[model samples]
Structures are given as structure tokens and as C-alpha cells.
Target: MSLQIYDTKIGKKIPFTPLRDNHVRIYACGITAYDFCHLGHARSALVFDMIVSYLRHSGYKVTFVRNFTDIDDKIINRAQKQNTTCAELSQRFIDEFYIDMKALKITPPDYEPRATEHIPEIIDIIEKLMTKGIAYQADGDVYFEVEKFPQYGSLSGRNLDDLKAGARISINKIKKNPMDFALWKASKPGEPKWDSPWGEGRPGWHIECSAMSRKYLGDSFDIHGGGEDLVFPHHENELAQSEGASGKPFANHWIHHAFVTIRDEKMSKSLHNFLTIREVLKRHQPEALRMMVFATHYRHPLDFSESGLRDAQTSVNRLYNCMAACAALTDGTESSKAVATRAEIDKLRSLPDRFQEAMDNDFNTAQGLGCLFDAVKSINRISQALPAPPAQADINLLRRGGADVTKLAQIMGLLSQEPQAYLAGYQEKHLTAVGMDKAELNKLLEERIAARQNKEWGRADEIRDLLLAKNIELKDSQDGTAWYVAGDRGQ
Candidate 1:
């Protein structure tokens, strides 16, 4: 199947061939940089990160740009509340955003333009709008004239008449029309200001993205993306400002990921239900959160819940266990003689193709993840059937299966850790979450081993019950005994 993208502009899935052959230029609207990133921000970042990964995996040379709005109303207000300069506050949060993105394993875009740094570019675009009669200056402020651009509402799928009907009467008397938005805001009491023709003022929110994206990705790029919440005024105004200024199409395709919600309500400060990325990271494995995000389709709402994260942890644990199992079977001490069938080898090798097929059809990561687990399930079943010290041919088959699953999983930034190391780290974290003393646990394990070795069955049973009561599950095998955190991790 040809790669397809669900373009929010045209409201349909289109066969996505780039504007230029063998190259894709993408620009995504980044955070405003006033606070720590939330789950919604993480989803947007990961969604585009997946897109970039898949495009490169498909042999497209990609140049991706994501811009930060460093000067906005929110930043000004937040700076005041924190008793700091807007630049200082924005920079601090941008640093925090990077830390969160790193923890989530998100790929950074090639160019990360800040609005304050691109003041000249912003002013140039605003001037272009003014020259084309698409913007007007009034009382030391500049506003985009929505009526000047006939295709104003096309990107957001809103007609002009309907928009005008639903539009509320703004209290601002300076704007020509109530629907018109600011291109440049006049300097406020203590907010950051820049010298522009409109007066000493900073660029407006929507204008910053248009200016920065053009500087990095040119007048027209292959793809533009953001959260769906940006579709209406933000992206719509950006579309109007860019196309109106340059008389060229701004971006060929537009993509928007849906929101992350809580109890069917969109995340907002008013509801107090949103979780920051670092906050969530403190309580759950970062990889587990990634799994949870990919479990749902990008355009579908993913409800935030503790149970959902626990389920994700279990799923991640299963995938890693599958890898660990393959490693053990493929250990070098196995029999060299070919004593097993090869029926499943070809099926195992076909996993990467299966995953790519899912990714090709509208970049369906949820479906792609399903393809990954399909291979894991087969490998697990085959491993269970094989004998101890399995034949070299069977071992070779397991190796191939493990290699195939790892190759595909990397595209989604999953299972990149060495199997044993990840499992061990998970155990350590689980140990900490349960408030179990590691040294004490080790002492108990040693004592239990001594009891088992001495055939003290009753004492061994008592120790086992004690550990199980604390949510530790024990398993006995030829290699000896091992334990796992059994129930709700509560982290």
C-alpha cells in the first residue's frame, strides 16, 4: 500500500507523495513554553516523531522543523506570577520540555526556532500581509483581516458565514472585525516587547509559527502538524497569514493528533485532571507510557487512567519477556544438530513487512504495534514447545525471530534496551515503588535458598507467603528461584 496521511485540511486520507520527490519537509507547532509539558504535549511530540521515523525508514530524506512560541500572553502572565522575565521563564520551561522529551525518547526536530529569535522573520511576514492588504495596523497594534483572504476558513472546514454567525462580540474596539486576530500585540505594562513598524510590540501567537516555519522549511513544506485543538483559529489563521503573504500554498499536507483526555473531558487547568510528563514519569516507566499512547489510534482519544498505565506495563513486560526467552533459547551451549522444523522461520522473517504495511496505511501505529506483538506471540509459543538445550536449527529460528521483532519495534522507539538489563531495571524500580528494602530482600532470598537446600519445607512455605503478601511472586525452575512484583505496582 502507498503511504497515506489523514489530511485535516481536505478532511480525507490522501495518498501522501511529497511535494518534492524523495524528500519530505515537515513543520509542527510546538509548545508555547510557559509550563511543563503535559500528556497532550507528549502525544503531539510522539505522533510527529513516529512520522519522521517512518518516513526515514521508508527512505525519505526528511527536514523537520518545530517552533516554540516564547513570547505569548501565557508566557507574560506566567512570568509575572513567577517574578521573572518572560525570557527567563520561557527558557526554563523549554529546558524542562527537552528533559521530558528525552525521558519519553522523542526525536527532536532538525530546527527548533524560537519566536523571539526570529523577530526579523516575523516582522517580514507581517509586513508582507500589510502590503497585500491582508493586515491592518490600528492604535499601535496589527491584526490580520480575515475578510481579505477568501479561503480563510477552508483549512479548519468552517465556512465564513457560519463562523461569523457563531463568532462572539469581542470587547476589543480596535479590531476591524470581531473574527480578526492579532498579528502583533502592542507592548503591555511589563511584558516583553520588540521594536516593529506597528510599534514596540511582540509577535502574536499564530504569526510566530508562520514566520519561523517559513524560515526553516521555506514558503511551502510537505507536511504541517499539531494537536487537533489548533485546527480552528491557530492553524486557520496561520494558513491565512502565510498563503496571503506569499501567494503560495503554505503546506501540502496537514496532520493533527487527537487530544489526551481524562474521564471523557479534555485536559484543562480548571478540571485539575491533567498530568505533566515529568509527573507521570515519576510514577510509571517511560516506556510503559509510550506503549499506552500507541495502544490507541492517534486520532482517537486516549483516556488517562492508572489502570491503563498498569496494563501498558504488563504489555511491555510481556514483550521484553519474549525477547529474554529468545535469548535464552539461542544461548551458545545448545545442540548443533538440526532436530527441529523450519515452518515458522519464513513467518518470523515476514514481521517487518507486516509492520510496514500497517504504517503505510494512514500511519496507523496502533495497528503497527499489533503487528509487532503478533510476531512476539509466535516466538513465545515456539519457545515453550522447544526442549531444554534446543537444537541449533531451532535456536537459529529463535534468533531470527528476535532480530525481526527488535528491528520493527525500534521504528516506534520501543524495546531498544537490552532485554536482561530492562527487566532488571524494571525490577529495581518496582522494588523501590513497593518500599521493599533491596538488602533485606536479598537477605530473605538467601535465607529461603538455605531453607530449600536444607529441605525445610514449612520454613520455605512461610517465607514464600511473607513475600507474596508483599506482592512478590516467586518462580522455581532448574536454574533456581526468581521473583517478580506481582500485583498493582502503585507507582
Candidate 2:
């Protein structure tokens, strides 16, 4: 089946056809690099990451570009406050952004261009717009004449008269139109600037993406995407600047992911409720955060909550637990990996097709996760149904089952860790959140082991109940007592 995605420009779900056969080029708007990265940033990064992952998994060669807004008004203001240069401040945060992304296990973009690095490209676009009469200079500042481009509001769905009525005051008094936005801003005292034909100034917000994308992905690319908040002024203005300069389509399709909200309100640092990736990682594994994102469809708003995040941690625990079980069931021997029977592993064999069906529909990770958990359930059932000294054929089937489930999960950037290692990390984080340490857990387990050895059943049960109250679960087998914080375990 062909891939389908919702195009924000056309405002409909359409069959995705790349401009080049078997190749896809995409550019996603990246961070402003003026502050620490938050969940809002995480959501956008993961959304695009999943899209790229699925595209490559489907055998398409993908070139992904996510840019950095290294030169901006925000960067200038923040630099003056911190007593640093715009270049230093912006690059500092750019490094911090990469740290956060690495902790989140985000795939590094193929090309990470910065506005400051592409000054020449920015100037070239502005010169083209100026020569074509699409943009004009007024008192050292250059503004795009919205009235000059007939398709100015096509992407944003705004009209001239309504927009004029909505804005009673023009941001720049000398501009020809109220809705006209800046292409180049004249330099201010102590602000970073590059010498240009328009005088000493920097590129405007919208113009940066146009120049960076054109330089990296050409005048027209297969896809352009970002957070929904950029649609109105940022993307709309970018669309105008690129097409107005090149006289061609800016992007073949546009993909916009919805906002991440907290308590039904949008997540933002200004609202004072934003949680940074660093803060979240201090209490939860990175894979847990990735799962929390995949739990919701990209086009839908993800209502953030502490409880919801904990649930995602629990879900990760279950996935890794299932992996551990499958491995334990089958000894890693050549005979154990041989094909058992077609009927024995039929459900396991159906993963790729089942997963592709969900993802092919606008990258529906939530539905793809549903398929994932169903396979998890199937393997778990197989593990439970095995006899004490399992037959060779069943071992082979279990080995195949474990490998198949892992392959599918890895596509969505989950279950990439060794099962034991993942479970240890997941348990440690939960342990820290609950104000307990693994040292304490080990001590308690030691005491319980003594109680069980003495055959003091009541004392042993009391210790188990005490740990259970702390959300730590336990299992008993011939190997003795084994426990991890596997969540509430259905109470």
C-alpha cells in the first residue's frame, strides 16, 4: 500500500507521492536556540523522527534537514541579558539542544544548518525578492509586500481585508501593508549583523527557513513540516518568500503536528508549566518519554500529566519484560533458532505487514503501538504456555518471536536496549521518583530472603506487601526471589 499523510497546505489527507522516485527530501523547522529544550520541542522532534523512520523503514532513501535559528531577536535579547555575544549565546543553547535530543535518542538530522552559517544564502533570496518587486526596502528595513504576492495567504487561509481589520496597528509604520512581514531587519546597537546590500542587518524569521531550505534541499522539496504554531506567520511567510523568490512551488506537501498541552492548555515556558527534557529524564528513562509520545497520534493534542508519564514508564517496563521472558524461554542455540512450524509462529510473522498498515496511514504510531502490544501479548501467552523443559520446536518459535517483536518495536525507537539493562534503568528511575534507592530495595530483599528461608510465611508475605505498596513487584522461581519496579502490576 502507498503511504498517506495529511497535507496542511491542501488541508486534507492525501496520498504521499515524492517528487523523485524512491527518494524523499524533507526540511523541518527546528529550535530557536535561546533557551533549554522542553516537551514542546521533544514532541515536534519525535513526530518528525517517526515520519522519517517509517519512510526509511519502507525502503525509501530519505534526506532530512532540521535547521537551527541561531540569529534572532530572542537570541539578541537573551545575549545582552547574559552578557554574551549572540553567536556565543545561540551556539551554547544549540549545544544544549543536541544534548537533550541525544538523551531522547532523536536521530540527528542529515544536515543541521544554522541561520548565521547561511548568511549569503539569506542575502541571495532577499536580492531575488527585491529585483522581482516582491519585497521593498523602507528606511533600512526590508519587508515583503504581502499585496505583491497574489497567493500570500493561500497556505495560512487568511485574506487581506480580514487580516487588516484584525490588526489595528502596523508593527512597522513604514510598511506598505499591515500584514507585511520583515525580510531583513536593520541592525541595532550591540546586535549581531552582517553587511548586506540592504545595510547592516540580519535575516527575518521566515526568510531564514526559506534560505536554509533552498540551499540544502533546493527550491522545491518533497516535504516541509513543523509545529502547528508556525503555520500562520512563520510558515505562511516562508511559503511566500521561497516561492516569491524562485517562482516555483516551495514544498510539495506540508505536515504540521499539533501542540502538546498541560491541563488542556498549551505547553509553553511563558505559562510557567513547561518541563524540560532534562527534568523529565531525571525521573524516567528516555524510552519512556518516546513511548509517551507514540501513545498519542501526532495530529492529536497530547495532554501532559505526571500520571500519564508514569503509565508510559510502566508500559516500557512491560515491553522489556516480555523481551526478557522470550529470551529466557529459548536458549540462544542454532537448533533453538531453527524454524519450528509455520502455524506455530504465524502471528509473529505478520508483524511487518500489520505494522506497515497502521504507519502507512499518516504515520499512525498509536495504532502501530496497538499492533505492537498485541504481539507482545501473543509472545507472553506463548511463554506462559510452555512446559517446564520445553521442546526444541517451541524454543525455536520463541526465539523467532522475540526477534520479530524487537525488530518492529525498534522502528518506532523503542526496545533498543538489552532487556536486563533496560529493566534496571527503568526500575532505578522509578525508584528515585518514589524517594527510594536500589540500595534500600536490596536491603529489604535481603531481609525477605532471610524470612523466606526461615519458612516464616507471614513475615515473608508482609515484606512482599510492603514492597508492593511502593509499586515494586516481585517474582519467585527456582532461581530464587527476583523483583523490579514493574509498576503497580494491576494492583
Report the CA-based lDDT of candidate 1 relative to the real structure.
0.87
TM-score to true structure, per model: 0.95, 0.92
Screening candidate 1 with a backbone cut-off below 3 angstroms (N, C-alpha, C), the clashing residue pairs are none
Range of the 10 consecutive residues with the lowest summed lDDT in candidate 1: 332-341
CA lDDT of each prediction against the hidden true structure: 0.87, 0.87
Pairs of colliding residues, candidate 2? none
Clashes of 1: 0
Candidate 1: stretches off by over 4 Å: 331-343, 489-491
Residues 1-491, model 2: lDDT tens digits: 88999999888889998898889999999999999999999999999898998899899999999999998888899999999998888889999999999998889999999999999999999999999999999988999999999998888788888788788664767988888888999999888889999899988888989998999899999999999999988999999999999999999999999988999999998899898989988866788888999989998999987788889978887899899887667453333334334544776778778889999999999999998887787777767776555667667666776887788788778998999877777677678777888789889888888888899989989989998888778888767788876454343
Model 1 TM: 0.95
Q: How close is candidate 2 to the true structure, as a TM-score?
A: 0.92
